[model samples]
Target: MNVYLAEFIGVAMLIFFGCGVLAGNSLKTSGSYGAGNVAINIAWGCTVAMVIFCLGDISGAHINPAITIMNAVMGTFEWSLVPGYILAQIAGGAFGGVLVYLQFIDHWEKTDDPHAKLTIFATAPAIRNNVANFFSEYIVTFGLAFCILGMGTNVFLEGLQPLATGCLIFLVGTSFGGVTGAALNPARDLGPRLAHFFLPIAGKGTSDFKYAWIPIVAPIMGATTSGLVHNALYKGIVDYRLFAMVGLTVVTFIAIKLASEDNKEAIKNKQALNQIA
Candidate 1:
């Protein structure tokens, strides 16, 4: 299969299964009541693992712009192909979100809660705090990218890397998902946000545009930082023994201090702009 085609299919499958869990939980008539955060997180991890297995040979199964960017930064993927991969991923994700909406249109109509409807389509904080939410996404994406970098380096573990990636995602979700719903993928968040904008779901809230940029910017930063860290470690600029300890310590510190501060400032600016408007 062509690489672009594989990306399309892989991303579609990701959204289908990942968003399927959201629909299962939120939609009243779906018969999947009580399926909560743990279920959604596991579904996301498994979806990623399955997609990678299905399309790894054909496309490396990035299915995410951040992953593609990281690969390019790490010299694994050609820069020329990044646009196509990102486009395919975004399209597939949007399509999958639409499919989920179609599957639960009746339930969406029945649910009068705007936040609940939007939650099914996009990520929101369990508690509405900019600092914690941004830190949550930053840490999750940083951990995920670090794991990807490690997997990319170990040739002997290449075949098992997807499973490792899946496990990292599971850990991140299980550990820190409560804050921001673990939207570690920009395409995953924005595609469904777009779906919520276009789909005829009543009472759907604003796409939370105020906080939307965090997932996109933070994940890219995390992925790029991970790539740079990996290169440093591989080149012996940093001791491999200290890689995890130093790398994670740096990532966590940056996430908590820099990203969270930036997010708070952005929120303040957005609120100021809204007030002026």
Candidate 2:
């Protein structure tokens, strides 16, 4: 199997179970309806571990672009392969979304809330606070990257590494999933979002494209930062990329705050106009 194909399949399976579980909880009449956070988080972790177990030897079971990017930046993965790996992961995510859609075909209409349908395929901020959402995603993904990288330093038995990594995902989910669903991977959110945009799901709402950048940008920032920190700890070499990325992350946070304020102002103006009418 080609490495790209392996990545595609790996991520496809990852989303199949991860998103499928969410669909079960959100959609009506499913056995796991309203299964709640514990179920969702554990399902995500188990899906991740299963994919890594299956694809670990073939493609290193990245299944997440954040981890791939971290490896590349940390000098473990080739930069040239980065684009293909990411593309494969996204494609896999789309395919996985399709599977979940089919798995819950009957439930889409049974589910009346467009927001729930949208979250079935993508993530949304629980509180709609952009700055807080960014902080949540960034910090969770940062922990994900930092811990996964830290795992590489140890010599785990063959099956244990996948379990450890999966447990790490569960930890992140259980701890920080409330904010932005803990989207620690760009492909994890983007691929399914593209699926949501294109697929024929009844009464599905906007794909929330405007908010999509948070998942992609925050995770990349977190991953790069984690790589820099891990490198410092492991090799003690200060890479200039660390400073650049940190500066950029700061700028991004400020931009999010500005955009959020603009959105609030727009809502206020619209509300006042409604009062006049």
Residue 107 of model 2 has an lDDT of 79
**Candidate 2: regions farther than 4 A off:** 273-277
Task: Score candidate 2 by TM-score against the native.
Answer: 0.95
The per-prediction tally of clashing pairs is 0, 0
Q: Once superposed on the true structure, which residue ranges of model 1 sit more than 4 Å away at CA? A: 155-160, 237-277
Candidate 1 overall lDDT versus native: 0.78
Model 2, span 99-184: residue lDDT tens = 99988888798878999998988888888788998888888888888898888899998699999988988988998888788898
lDDT of each candidate versus the true structure: 0.78, 0.90
**Clash pairs (backbone) in predicted model 1:** none
What TM-score, over all chains together, does every model reach?
0.82, 0.95
lDDT of 1 at 156: 53
lDDT of 1 by residue, 100-163 (tens): 8887777776666788778776788888765666667766787788777776667755567777
